[model samples]
Target: MTRLFNEPSQFADELVKGFVAANSQWVRPVAGGVVRRAPTVEGQTAVVVGGGSGHYPAFGGIVGPGLAHGAAMGNLFASPSAQQVHSVAVAAENRGGVLLTFGNYAGDVLNFATAEARLNSEGIVTRTVVVTDDISSAPVGQEHKRRGIAGDLTVFKAAAAAAEAGYSLDEVVRVATEANDRTRSIGVAFSGCTLPGQTEPLFTVPAGRMAVGMGIHGEPGIAETDVPTANELAELLVSSLLAELPPSIATAQDARAAVILNGLGSVKYEELFVVYGRVAELLEAAGITVVEPEVGELVTSFDMAGVSLTLFWLNDELEGFWRAGADTPAYKKGRVGSPSSASTAASTADTQSFAEADRLTLAAETAASLPTELPDSSDASRDAALAIADAIEAIAEVIDEHADELGRIDAVAGDGDHGIGMQRGSRAAATAARSAALNGAGALSALSLAGDAWADRAGGTSGALWGLALQSVGAALGNTTEVTGSAVATGVSDAVSGIQSFGKAVVGDKTMVDAMVPFTERLSREVNAGGDLVTSWRAAAEVATAAAAGTADLLPRMGRARPHAEKSLGTPDAGAHSFALIVVRVGEVLASRHSEFA
Candidate 1:
């Protein structure tokens, strides 16, 4: 469980601030995340790596001369938005092209691919090599389906080293892709991690048992069994990886590989060393040689009692790149160069008086931006906008009631941050909607502002999708119009279209689309039949509730749940359930204000 935090929603922002203050010598604050304080060589391709926070020394902690030029940090267990990645790419561009590399997750894929396209349109050459190295996530001959874990380090290092050696963007991407193709990783956890301010763990391992193949974001394991002896555990890990050798390795014998024994948060150094001892013997017995193996905590989930093993098969070129020097804030190898100017005694001469103020100013400047200008509105529109605020209040209240339960559902096969993400997004949306309504904004402007706040504050797939839904609705009901049942129904239908297009999920994907599609269709039919807003919403909410409940019998075909599809059976899709829950509450709110759209 998490204990120390001022505000749960602000945890990611606060930690980044503290990290920059302490590691100013290696990194400086950027709009989205962090970048190296030290300058880089001219015309060197920039390597930008990032994902969600909580996994330290992965995204931000590896920003340095011989590593990534910048990192785009996201909320805890959530991928950074496309805008966040773009910000970091812009900051790191140095006349050469940009290479974005990170773990392969659904949100990260959507966000980073969007950023890559955006950068290309602006005449900046950008490419990506998504790391998919976790052997347990997918079966043989389906390596592309695997997710990245501790192996993120290997791919990021390969790209950075290539860039440091002045490789072109195309060559850097090639090297990183090859590194990812060769890397294999597997992880196991003794217990689950708890999110900040949460009362319980996302999912728990039974006492005297261990979970195999759990994800860093608290995704439940694919298999669980009684705890094994240290030697037995090492044998399991080693044998599992050995069964699926990389295509680059013709045989295991006499092959050299870069090895990493990663401790996920609470696992200590001595324990890792003990595990590595047996791992080394197993490799030696098979005639496989290990080179420059790292045994420590590199990538981590906050306080997760787990360990992961990564093997990066080394060819001649890869071995050279793997041994390259890097000097980040957390992870370090051989000396990259002289200490950065930020670390000089001269720079620290006045550390007492201005440090705290500087930190505060940096945090303010780095905060995510929100929309400010409100659209034109009339008196009637302003009155109608009040309903939007009331509806958001109801949504927030319902989420507050069932957040823990939503987390549990998500933990069945997902990262288990759905509840926390929704809590932050809804609270921010409610505040924004209320302020907009009070300030004379119309339904269009009020809802749009709230959408911006939700997406910016929450920073996840759910946040982005929900924000898009609000914006789509608000766009349909432009300011200064007479609000009607037909208009509201049309808005929801438009939202369904936009969400499907943006998220690339279809009706039977076992996502929110399953329930949202039904709700929108029913609402459109009811409105077409001359039903009032309250009546139509109530009818739609009922349909949504049943559809959401029906998702329990289906297997997920999209997002994080796809890898652990079987584990998610008998549990409703958290996104669908939350969406249905919100609409049901909104229907109740509309019933009280039934005369507004009459």
Candidate 2:
């Protein structure tokens, strides 16, 4: 377990601070993450890469002369907020356009896509390359649905190299896409990792057994079996990747690949070498020539005792870029020439000034702007805002009370962060709603602000989904005189639709949608029958609770849990349960405040 940490919530921030201090020669701190201390060529495309924290050397550690220009670091196992990504991108941007690259997880996709849109809106050209190289997350036909794992390094390196070599933004994107398509990775874990302050690991493997196709986020593997010998493990990894060679590679005998035997966290370099030795022998036996193979921790999950192998199929152009010189704090290759003196001086000054200015701007923008006194809105609007605040406060308390239970449920088949994420999001949302209410914002505005805070603080798949749901509902609520039963029902319907659209999860996917759809349907029906807000919401909450309980009998069909669907059969989805709890608690608050409407 992670013994070293001041506070669980402050871990990511402190890690970044210490990292920048220790690697001053290579990286400098920005508002959201780290940027290269050494300036890039002016008008050259900048490659920005990032993801959740705990995956060191992957993101921040790779920011330097020949790798990522900047990295938008997030909380542990969570994607950075869109604001964080945008700030880092702005600090990293030069005359050339920017190319954003990261793992293909839901939160990362949502936030990165949001950042890309925002950048383009601001007239800063931007492109994105989502790395999806893990073969275990999806089938061959649904490759787009696969999650990114250790192969993030290969794709990021290729993009960064192309950018460093003065490729256009489009060309850099092309190369990164090709790298992702040609690369394949598979991982195995002896044990799961623990988050800071958490006494237990996310998941556990039985003694004398190992998990195959395990994700880096402490998610249980798809299959578990007796631990194999070093040679056998290596063979399993190689065979799995070789079985799915990219179309560009004509045959195994004729393939040339750049291989990476990556340690997740606690696995030592000696063990990696032992595995790589066997891996190299097998590849040679298959007549594949391995290029400069890397064996060490590149992407990690806290202190997970696991390893993943990545094979990047190579052609002439890819091999050239793969061998290109790189000088980062944690990774370095062949020597790279020094930048021009004039450009270096100018770039240094520009970087310092831009970083400082952006930091101040971000600080100002993020600061709370609560009013000392309520604004002069309608009395009905004020009452509605207060009611919303009360509901959110109730929701927060309920989530906090059951957070541990929810985490336990999630750990059965997923990374066990759902409870913590929901707690964080709900607390942030409650605080934001209270502040907005104090400032005399209408119900719609308050909820919208709350949604933003939830997404910003939570920083995960659930966080993003909740944020979208709340924002969609708030938009449907509007800022009119008073919130009516019809409006509330319409808002709930809109939220359900938004979540389905955003996550692509249907009602039976064993996600929050399972509960949410039932709740929305019931609420709409009750409201259409001329019921009051409290009555309709209470009825909907009951339906949601039953629907959530019913999820115990269904198989998971989405997210990380999909791979371990059978394991999750007897457990309720953490998200669905939490949603049910929140709605029920909020309904109680609504009932208590029914007098306000009267």
Highest TM-score model number: 1
* TM-score of each candidate structure, all chains considered together: 0.90, 0.90
lDDT of 1 by residue, 1-598 (tens): 7899987767888999899888777777776698877777778999999999889977899898788899999888998877778888887889899999988888888878888998999999999999998887778888887888999999999989999999999999999999999999999999888788777676678899999998887665569888888888889888988888997788999999899999999999999999999999999998998989999999999889999999899999989998999888888888788436645553445454235545664566544354456678977778878988999988889998998888879878888888878887898899999988998899999889888777756667888888889999998887898888898999999999999998999988889999999999999999999888898899999999999999999999999887668878989999999999999999998888766564
Q: Candidate 2 residues 1-598, lDDT tens each?
A: 8999985666788999888767766777776787777677898888999988888887899988778899999877888878678878988989899999999887799889988999999999999999989898778889998889989988988998999888999999999999999999999999889887678888788889998988898655568888999999999999998899887778999689999999999999999999999999999999999999999999998889999999999999999989998888888888775422332445666656645754675566466333444434577776788888898899889988898788789878887777767777889899999988877787778888889878877777788788888888777766566678888888889988988888889988999999999999999999899889899899999999999999999999888787678889899999999999999998889888986553
lDDT score at residue 64, model 1, on the 0-100 scale: 86
TM-score for candidate 2: 0.90
Q: Cα deviation of 53 in candidate 1 (Å)? A: 2.2
- Pairs that collide in candidate 1 are none
**Most lDDT-accurate candidate:** 1
Model 2, residue pairs in steric clash:
none
Q: Alpha carbon lDDT of residue 439, candidate 1? A: 86
